[model samples]
Target: MKLVSLITAFSLISGLVEAGNERKFTTIQPDLTEIRKAQATAQPYEFKEEYVPGKVFDRFYNIWLENTDYDKAAGEPHMKDLRKKGITLTNYWAVTHPSQPNYLASVAGDYFGLDHDEFVRMPANVTTLANLLDAKGISWGEYQEHSPYPGFQGFNFSNQETYANDYVRKHNPLVLMDVITSDETQLSKIKNFTDFEHDLEAKKLPQWSFITPNMTNDGHDSTIKVAGTWSKNFLEPLLKNDYFTEKTLVVLTFDENETYEEPNRVLAILLGDIPEDLKGTEDDTFYDHYSLISTVQENWDLPKLGRNDCGANVFKIIADKTGYENIKVDMDGVYNNKSVEGWFSDKHIPLPPPHCCE
Candidate 1:
């Protein structure tokens, strides 16, 4: 269900901090005050110009805004899947369009201001989520769905079936392999999702696990239904397992919104052993990929990675672990079906078809 609360006042500034030799800055914390001001200035549930076009897409945006229900959208069911065995990010989001940019954003927060995917070698100064986590002695892995090794080119990114497991990892081959392969523990963490099944069953997983499901299963290569099904099949089983829940956080998020017109659009859900006060309740707080990076760093008491260190904080999706009321429905108020009707029609918003679908 959707919960709407009017937010109020604050000073949302943007800039950098230079203390001694270290550079510091704030993440993209939503200006609740700004949101409240905008809400007060505009009518409730009205579509903002940024999220809608003239007439067609505006209708969709208006409908989505009015509905305001997070549960209405299609997503995985059965929290007992294999992959979601711990903390979940109900309001997680990726930074930009296309998988590469979002992936980089998730790891480095800001994509280094690159507009397109270019396989150039990243500089030593370019810090990643992995780097930050490592600096703090917290182990982490990218866990590309099909990769066997951990390095700059370990993540598979090909359309072919066989090549998927062995393709290069980044848009730019210029990435430093040392940064990727230096950590033995972190490198060992990278594995195929299928490889995690044995670990899940054996109750042998690392302290902090960061997984990147295959393109097809994580809403990148196939229908949303397919993605949901795969998520439920793999992640749900683990969340329901007691062995994985003691002190873990699980996050499943979309890399970016389906359309550019809906610029600040992405899906993130959190699940796991969070404080009782922050479980099960849905939060509408504005957030993005960088926020997640910040959250992780904050959780582990590590220094912030690159731009995301102070960009945004993940919205508190569930605040109490009492478990939700299990309210599943489509946008039309239909029970069972998860897909929203007319969510992306020509009548709803003005945007090109989804990149993968097209």
Candidate 2:
């Protein structure tokens, strides 16, 4: 009897070892120390050719050269590490310049086409992609991290309005909006990132969810290492989370590429619930903020609303046939033609508006 028990124990131990070996971990981590060190070495400011102006195609081609270099020399290894751990996106695009506009564009499908931070409520005439989702009876929520102060809690709330609303209202205006407006209780559904634990524990997940991590960690002005680390720490686990992996899609992208001229490249990462043809692939498709709006419209079958809509192309990052079965075309072949030297043409020109408030 003792010999038989010993044999069973040995078999269990061997199985554990094999299972451990089969699991792969991501290579990237939010390394604040490394990020700070790298930033220390960066020169105060320097120009690069990628910022120069030309045709859209030529401009992107030139920018790609340096971006390829920057990624290869700095962030490439981390990207590979992410891929090994199942975090990847074949084609992604930065939604806009500055930050807030991109965020608005993602949900609204029009940059609201605003030029300033004026907090006017989105016009009733403008149809938002979020509204479209609401109509379809698909559930959705915005998972804001460290909010409760910025008035992001509910839909239709803005950062500027948090003052009168107090902590919860200030932080999550979106929730408040739905509370007052949406009859389906969609506002109740919007939650803080921490709330993810409860949903996971209860085994409840909506068809669509939008998550936004806080300022410090999201790679806005922070060092790439810090951003990458935050991404790894939060995302690595979520990728493995059973609920997220099966039908969910995770999009990681910058609001804007910022002022960097060299590399002139920002990131767009998509993962989860992708079709076989679209999975584990990388696309050099030329795209911008409007592309995201276009994608959301296409996914929900919503109508396009602005000037960009007429010509905008949505690059399908996840082509899950079983779920989002929209046929995709090659976005690269679409006309990249521009009347002027592309948007970057103004890089060297004198600014119509000064750095200070005009």
Candidate 3:
């Protein structure tokens, strides 16, 4: 009965995801302006905990953008300018196609074979990077550009006037995992950009943060140029912000590549309190979505997820700072263009149990 019920739930979730493609968001106003006005009334929860220092950096911030091939993104005027301010990850690859899976993999160390941008949720038993950080009393949060409110579980909110995909659930990694979504306290930490502003001003930002801009700003609905411009404008001022950058590691990266036929390489820029000699440099070491998890774990000595993160390379800079050697991957034919079968996939192959201590 337990096994059957679990399978039934997975099938139902898959059905809802397929049906959600055309469904208008009912919880929030369909009009983007009205939605923003309404969301203003939602109290943004302020959470601040002890700053657990990591080996290489005190705080880590990752800003995620949308689809753009490595060269296309790297060649953008604003991106090029940003590259000169920090280390450019020349060989960093995304884990898979579409977008959401890469975000999921970044925190969970695996995407469980999800293939598309769908309204799916993981079971409560599944844990993520948050748990690892929580275990060590480290603080973390996610700031999504246009999320209606903290702890929102809607499929996709759009502009009723333009019918554009605005704040999407798929782009927000923590929302997909039930481990975070099920807990009200954890959900409060998954806030919008407005909350980010409040936190930033109060100097109450978490030790680790995952930031995702709106669909348009992130280039999902626009071009790489727009995303690059938005990224530079948003991150440039923080370079001198004392509260934000003392021994901090800021990463600018994409969820996945725009081209499905090519390898899933994306342009990533490393900045914020980096060693001066490493700035304006290019690191060609092979990396993927799992590298995000590995890098965080390496810095904080967090427990292994016992999945892909176990084998993923830590950020070379973090490795060098912490005296940990990063592994070099031989990328001959590791093209993660399509996802395989799992609980969320159309095939609905049951997901394996989470290996907490593998």
Best by TM-score: 3
Per-residue CA lDDT of model 2 for 168-247, tens digit only, reads: 22222233222223433444455555565655565555545556555445543345566667767776777677655665
TM-score of candidate 2 relative to the true fold? 0.56
Cα lDDT of all candidates, in order?
0.41, 0.42, 0.82
User: Residue-wise lDDT of candidate 3 within 16-116, one digit each (tens)?
Assistant: 54322331222322465655775666565576577888898989899999889999999999999988889999999897878878888888877876777
Q: Which candidate model has the greater lDDT, 1 or 3?
A: 3
Model 3 TM-score, all chains together: 0.87
lDDT string, candidate 1, 1-358, tens digits: 2211100110011012121322122222224354345334331111111211111111100000001123323243533232233333344344444445555555655443333433433444455666665565544434445533333232234434544322335422223234554554434445544545655565555444456555555555555666666667665565567776545556665555554444334445565554566554455454565665655554445565434345355334321222212222223321211111111111222211212200
* Residue runs of model 3 more than 4 Å from their true location after superposition: 1-41, 160-163, 346-348, 354-358
Order of models, best TM-score first: 3, 1, 2
TM-score of each: 0.57, 0.56, 0.87
Candidate 2 residue spans exceeding 4 A from truth? 1-77, 85-91, 117-120, 149-186, 260-265, 275-279, 300-311, 317-358
For candidate 2, the per-residue lDDT at 208 reads: 52
**In candidate 2, where is summed lDDT lowest over 10 consecutive residues?**
57-66
Candidate 1: C-alpha lDDT: 0.41
